[model samples]
Target: MRLVHPLSVVRDAQDWTYQDVVDIVAKATKRSADRRKAWKWENWGVEPDAESQAALAAALGVPLGEVHRLGWPGWLPDGGPVRTSFPWTMAGTLDALDDTLEHAMPDRRGFMKLGGQTLTLLAGQWLSQTPDALAAAFAGGPVDEQLVEDLESGLPRLRRLEAALGGHRARLLLDTELATVTDLLKQASYTEKVGRRLLRLNAELARLAGFASFDAELHAAAQRYWTTGLRVAHAADDRALGANILKSLSLQCYDHGLATAALALATAAVEGAGDVTPRTRAMLLLRQARAQAACGNRVGCDRSLSEAETQIARSTTTDDDPAWTEYFDPAEFHAQTATCYADLHRPRLAEVHFTTALDLMSPAKVRDLATYTIQSARTHTALGNADHAVHLLERAAQLAASAPSHRNTTRVLTARAELPMTKKDPKVQRLDELLATLSA
Candidate 1:
């Protein structure tokens, strides 16, 4: 889960034979990389010798000494097809779309290990990319504008499904939808206008799918989906949505305790959010605040949160914001801000924002409500309000049971474990029994 060998990413992109790497290394270094050694080098946790690694690096066009600095797979290309690396182009986007469609189900590895170089490269590419040539038409079934619009209209419903069910239950639907769009892109012909819209739709779908995977805690799937989404955004020339994807990736990193990488992605998201609405900008800023808090940058976190509050108020009056961002109203802003305070260990302030978030949050946002409820319970525990804390845990447990999310289940367990009086409090003891059933 941590170290994805370059053999997979590069071989898939270049259609290299299994022995190709062995041959290349042998040719470069005149070293013995036999079949067993090559097999270990390509697919497992085994580290190749320095000389062999150098030879492979050379073959991949990586700097020779990079092997020593990054140490094995860290020095390898991004954890994706090499062609989709950077300087976004139509060809790269198309290849990503096709690859996404082909692999609707990535291996659900338990951890996400996005290298620093990969994340940095993607952010740089998004910020630097401008309109390239439109993709040439493909030879497949004919696709009309009407079908594309119909798909576009249905996107909101899918988003709702993901929000309600979280990624575990909803990713299959999103992936299917993504596949349909990819089919249209690759198997049909359309006008440039239609093509652009289709690409935009695909990009959004990929983003949703990626987040769903993240929500479900399928880390590898999330990385693949998000990376593909970023590439599709480049094709559609939609930096706003691309920035959102970057933020999503940032959240993934932060949740996994990758503060520095998370900060990098969040910084890029804020910087690359070009010409977005006030609300959208607020969303990006809020994300930056969260990343800053994760990085222990109290000053930066406070600054971003202050700016985000000002922008959220203005975003309310505007009607031109993207539909995917409709969740970032006043209620969600409090929830997000509360998240930052929780990270900063300002339990009292976190309680205030969580309370407001709970009051203003719509019933439809079950997942968000559940998340805030659990965090609220923790804050109450810190404040020595055991009874109130137990009450919140009860509500959070209800939401988790009703929704059936492994991620939420894990949260419920963690929250229960953190309760100061879980052993002595009868209500908490009963809660532990209930928790047993949930975990089971």
Candidate 2:
């Protein structure tokens, strides 16, 4: 006899609905109306005996173990002792199939179309559990795994919702949601509760999809998310969370080269995170320093960096810190500081920081490698070491090739431009040739 896994049997039976399964069993048995009713046990009735159990299994073409698994009345032949052989229930089997379907269909657009009703129902389920999920996911533990899984599960539904609404309609819906959330914030009693927190998360999701618009109207959406998230954090009386949200906004500004705005946001975060933990304060200050350096404010940047170091030193324990701020460490700070110095044309200072930063970096942060290598080349060029600069730039170019980023490509191109002016350099010529190949 062929043995099938209980799970596989359940999956194969999924195409037959509950009612369909009952109908199939009824027809196969060819019982009279009263006998069919007795065998199916639609209402509460006595359990089936061993002979009846065998008959039902033969009709259903499923293992008797499968029927006995549910532990329902009439599940066993003659309502005998509970069957230990059955490993899973029909419901459990169906649920496994449901989970399998959800996992197999990760792409948002496809699933929404294929399972619209199921997607909607699951979305509601996720929303109902949002508060608990958020707390656990952000709390640092096995919760992150579940949180990611939930997000993955909900993504298809969200995509479907977006597709149904289209661009303009979706923006309108987001705007309306944001307005409702803002109004909720006005009521002091609800400010610190689950309602406000959910709204904050909703705003963040809207911002993530905003860039998909044609005109790229994501800036307003991003600001809405940050602002709402800050208010929610404040309501929760979580200073670190508020600071982290502000830090995200500052990084966005920095990405756009809005140095002044980035600096302002980072400084505000440092100040507003009042009496916040020393580690959090250091992180905010580090961001401030990075922004200042980007703006060519050498003195201001150095001052912020020093302050950050001092704060880090003052911390006795960093174990209970926020998840977002955990990425800041001595090496990361030094690397960022090196980039600042390089931008300011202080090659010696840049070299010191870059070396320290490089030493601290892990192999996983491969993208950072290109940035650090490029900085090293620029520093060498500034120091009048053309040979070393050429060698470093070549390495930087090779790294850049492996990972294509427009911003890093621009940096490499600029570095190549500087090579021609170096005095009587074969290395410079060779570097130029390599860069030429890249352009082609």
Candidate 3:
């Protein structure tokens, strides 16, 4: 059996230094370690205490027993073999889809540590046109306009639910709907034209499902669903939807700190967008700007943002735009800009855009408002305005109370973790109390 080093496992799973791991372990175990000892243990090997093992599992975003299983001889007796790879099949995809839908996501550490081979496999899966065995399992039945209308009508409601509540519930609902659609497509019959339309609808649902999963912080599931959606889009020859999905994948990569992958994906989205409307084009360009910002290409980022603005200015109607793109307005544009600046560590500039974004915060986009509030709080903290940061966090907390988003909660906790406040501070204590309730 190959021996796996604990530090190496930590490095593969998350972006944290040795000291960071030591600090987390110390806090979890209620044991203090000097820097020298921490470095020595990290460089060597040591049996972890119970709390340290639990903390390592939490930090690596896996089950506690999984951590015990990582060591040779399997320290956690009776535990099953640990999965060294993500499942790569239709059944695996559906199972993961169901998991995301029915359960809260696993701890979502970012994706900078994701292996290059994983990215390659995902990209290949997305671009491949191979027939799925599941599609062939059931006989086809008759397709109709009524069926299409029923599916289409449900879309708006899912979008609303995701916006009003959070991604976790919405993702589950979509997964159930998608399972039904998959069954319909497998068992139901249709003409070539109708089949194409149904495939397009399937692609849309898959893409939305992926977005909901992402919002819920089910990162790996989101990537898989997005790839599946892209495959469906290609079956329908829906280049526009394909581009949209590609752009979304790029955003996911950017969120995970894979800037190079993000830039490549964004570029692919823009190049393949074909005859998409100006609004759609603008949205894609904004995504490119985000990727560029992540790559620290300030000039390129500025150019992309400028191009997006020009495209938005020229867009008159959404008639040519896809239904999924109705939310890309001035406020969203400003919010994206603020995020780019925030990523670049330009808090002053981020502050300017965030303020404008707050002014334009649409009442319908509760989750977006909460996200922006947290981003604004981050900016305030960066600018040494702890008081203002606390105020913004309070507002965010209030919004989160009504919305109940896992993503928002994680962001709030992460931002709070960065603050200089000790547990003795009232605000810090309040945050801890709030987090307890949220996790409950």
Candidate 4:
């Protein structure tokens, strides 16, 4: 997910197509427009002159230095300093994460990768329940069952917060709660059975944090947290949880347009989900459909989607599903099907599914409504319904005014960018103005 150039930040921030930036740069620099298309695709790199760099900096509303780093071209500061210094204990892990958030929170380029030390720490947590260590650690206070129960009870509410307020608002809160839970795990000693449960809960917390980070577009941070969650899940021997995390990673890759990587990951998710509940299986299949669509595998996409729907129809509540599996429902199936159709450019089918999903969505799920509206609008725009698309876009804007998820914001912007209208179009102009004020 590393960006090739700093200008990619502008591309992401403004939701501008690469061609748009190339044209702007060409016009501003009085350069040949003939080279713009090739440059846009980066078939070959074009070294920007001083004037062109200045124009790009001004156009992107960033400092010139930020627009193009000299000598070495990377988001990282020169010489790559060590990002972690804490020990391998639970308290040390939390401290490392706090330090990570401080340095990486403001800029995606600054997000730290999971270093070897952190992996060693998680491996130690996995080994801590060995017979010799368990007997020796009888000195600490016994693990409190009540604290674990309290943490478990609050998860659904935290999930609801993520749904309503978006991941930008929930990431920090989830991290705070994770820190508290880790503090408990550090202080409270328990038997192997209790210890395993605690680790499972910690894994869930880390997975949620990763999910929030992914939604907020802190991509590298998301990867780090997701990998940490995977390690924790393996430590806990929670195959279902691990599969779910891999599915999330697949979705992230699909969103980034890495269809090949996404397909492999989604396939791995399905393969790794041994003896999974039906609902979880269906969700994984839906993710597989998305990845297939991204890869231009029409037949494979349709087959996977059919299997997903059939599995959804057969799913039942008594399937012994994980708590996270509760969120997937008939409406979600329809919404995801709409996404698959949208990707395949089957606009008519996409419109039908998106409309039905929207109708089924509860008003309480404001973020879902907003996201679906954007999806439906994209279908409409593809089908040559500019006015209808604009109408839906306005509704989406209203819904997003209160809850601005970075993921949804990017979707809306990309959809807006795809409209077959000139800059002079009033609706297009309005969208441009509206986007200028939306939170990034």
Candidate 5:
């Protein structure tokens, strides 16, 4: 007879408790009392005796005395060789989580040490399953707060991960996953649940790639990420997510001087996200107005802006908006509008919007500060106020140095370049010097 570990049998039978195991054994062997006597009986031509117990003990690699002490004849063993199995069994799952926590905690001790590579791995695993498991791993506490806080604090790490992945690798990974997800979604049984998961994954992948492309100075590539992200969001039937992706794409287009494309994309986003939550509608409208302004469509820009403001005012509560969509506020909308006006050479309007945006900005967003300061500086330069432009530029440069973002650096450099042509005054020399320093 082949021997099996008694504990393994208990686990397999879902009878881990000693009382449950005792009941199971009594039922299996048909012995209400005297388990030893039952084990000593030879029945159905199977080995069942003291000699069998000794043999089972040897097979289990445990001492015979230990088996006898348990008050069992031990026809089967206490510990025996079992067939190799998948490593992700329930017990293994707990073990894996423990091991992951052990490895992750020490490395993540400091906020500065957090990176995208680690967060991606951890988040991918944690977010893949039910929140219950993750909560249990965290000692049965709430997971939502931790997840949000971690993601917010780990944005820089995610940015680095994007940089490390680059365009080609990111594209390949996203395309492959997209194909697999598409196939999965075709199955009737998995159409709803799995489709939603695939859509979320696709959106996240594209967002990451988009950020990477932006960091690498590949605006076109970034646009592609947002475009694909929008498609995936639509497939998932997440209008809010689709609108957000479109907003991002529009901003990319505007930044790259494709103002018309930006407007078109933003318009499409608003239309496709029809009857969406008020906040989302307002955000899309804001993006549309910004794009129109950038393209010099003053009347259209003003109309869109008015519509956005109206929608924002009507949205008395943000409860209808998606969780991710909460990042956009009136300030961010106004700041982007200011950037559009600055691009259109409407300095007064730009200044008003910029001032509003500056007041609304949080101290934690250093990168955003650098970007907005650069935009403000450009607006001042366009108005031929070289002194204010220089001062803003100085502050922007200082912030940019700390943030060290390629996109922000490029924006500042481009703004500085424009100053030399716009200002014939001696300040042009200072602008030239700043441009040289940026180049160096």
Candidate 6:
């Protein structure tokens, strides 16, 4: 058995893929590597050329001499692997949360991590884990109920601020708040009722922190928050919240073209969520539909979308659902529907849904509004409405400029790339110029 290549092991430990290594090598050492050549180094244990080894060394922040001393995999830095298979117990949940808080710093590499098989394994664990297998008991100072309630009450306000400003502005604040909640859980004694509520709050804060990290384009940070949040939610016996975190991870994976993992996560989300409100089901199903669409499962996608629509229609303002889920209004529903159609290459249908969503969306959701606007412009471009597309791009550009979200700004950048550079129209040229300045 050619034991798992050390090169491959090192890449996994660093939470990167072949492309990430290639790009980083070029950036770090100004040396370009053919993808096929790099793949052989990992898959076939081929010794890289001196320059390639030097580039890899620089990318991994290791001494170049190590390449000669240890050779190949031996010279590669061992950063350790990212852990995902935590036991489904309260103690395990606490440990996961604590580990992430202490060590999972933001991915300074600013790239998505490789999770090909790990994502599937994670969802499988979530699906099979027992719900609230053990009760939590804490012996500490008395926890003030009012303080817990105050923190809970402030959640909506934090969300509002996140929607109005960008995630970068809100992420640190969310992390700080989560740390406060975690400290209370560890040090302050509370009744069973209070403890449960605090645990749920911890879960929600972690989930919100993940969402903020994603919006800020910190992929590894988002994963840390999301996985920890899922464990916390499971500990609280909040199946719906746990499912919601899975859906968020699914969306992130889908955004990065990890279709298999995205689909697995989505399936786990719906299957694991028991006895949720109609809108909550709708949100999860919509995510599942997108993954299905990405996988070319038109039948499954259509079925899931239809079911999502039915569930959403049944949802009412009076439903006893989590307050955070109220955002699954007509706007969010249609936007997700549009995403599925966009992935399926049905631009006309996507444009129609995007139009409806924009019509219903509140201006307060600046980051979302800006992102969807850019996406809607892409559909317009696909439909060959160049003139109208330019108009929409201009509108999206203004929206993007107003928001500080790295995600929203990235959408604008992507849209700029999709445009026809040769188009001499002043509006098109102007849109490009305005977008080019954003990253600067």
How does candidate 2 score on lDDT?
Answer: 0.52
Error of 2 at 273 (Å): 2.7
lDDT of 4 by residue, 155-215 (tens): 9998888877787688888877777766655666776666656767777877788778777
The best candidate by lDDT is 1
Which lDDT tens digits does candidate 3 get at residues 1-440?
11123353344446656677778878777788455544555445555666766776676566766666665213332212212133444444444444433332332322222333455445554445343333333356677777787887888887788778677777777777777776666667766666667777877888888788777766655665676676667666777898889888888787766888888788778877678888899999989899999999999998998998898888996357788897887889899989988988899999999999989978778788888999999999999998788888888887887887777887888888878777898877776777677666
Return the candidate ranking by lDDT, descending. Answer: 1, 6, 3, 4, 5, 2
* lDDT (0 to 1) per candidate: 0.81, 0.52, 0.71, 0.70, 0.56, 0.80
The ten-residue window of minimal lDDT in model 3 covers: 75-84
The positional error of residue 417 in candidate 6, measured at the CA in angstroms, is 1.9
What lDDT score goes with residue 372 in model 4? 92
Better of 3 and 5 by TM-score: 3
- Candidate 1 per-residue lDDT over residues 1-440, each given as its tens digit: 32235556666666666578778888888866466676776656688778787877877788876777878677777454323453477776777777666654664544565665678777877788786867567787667888888999998899888887878789999999998888788778887888889989999999999888888887777888888898888788888999999999899888878888888898999998888898999999999999999989999999999999888777656458988888887888998999899999999999999999999999878878888899899898888887898889888888777666667887878888777773867898878877787777
| Candidate 2 per-residue C-alpha lDDT over 184-275 given as tens digits, one digit per residue, 9 for 90 to 100 | 33332321234335433433433323322211223333343444344444434555566666666676667656777677677666766767
The residue pairs in collision within model 1 are none
TM-score between model 4 and native: 0.74
TM-score order of candidates, best first? Answer: 6, 1, 4, 3, 5, 2
| TM-score pick, better of 2 and 4 | 4
* Top TM-score hit: 6
Write the number of the candidate with greater TM-score, choosing between 3 and 6. 6
- RMSD after Cα superposition, model 5: 25.3
Worst 10 residues of 4 by lDDT: 127-136
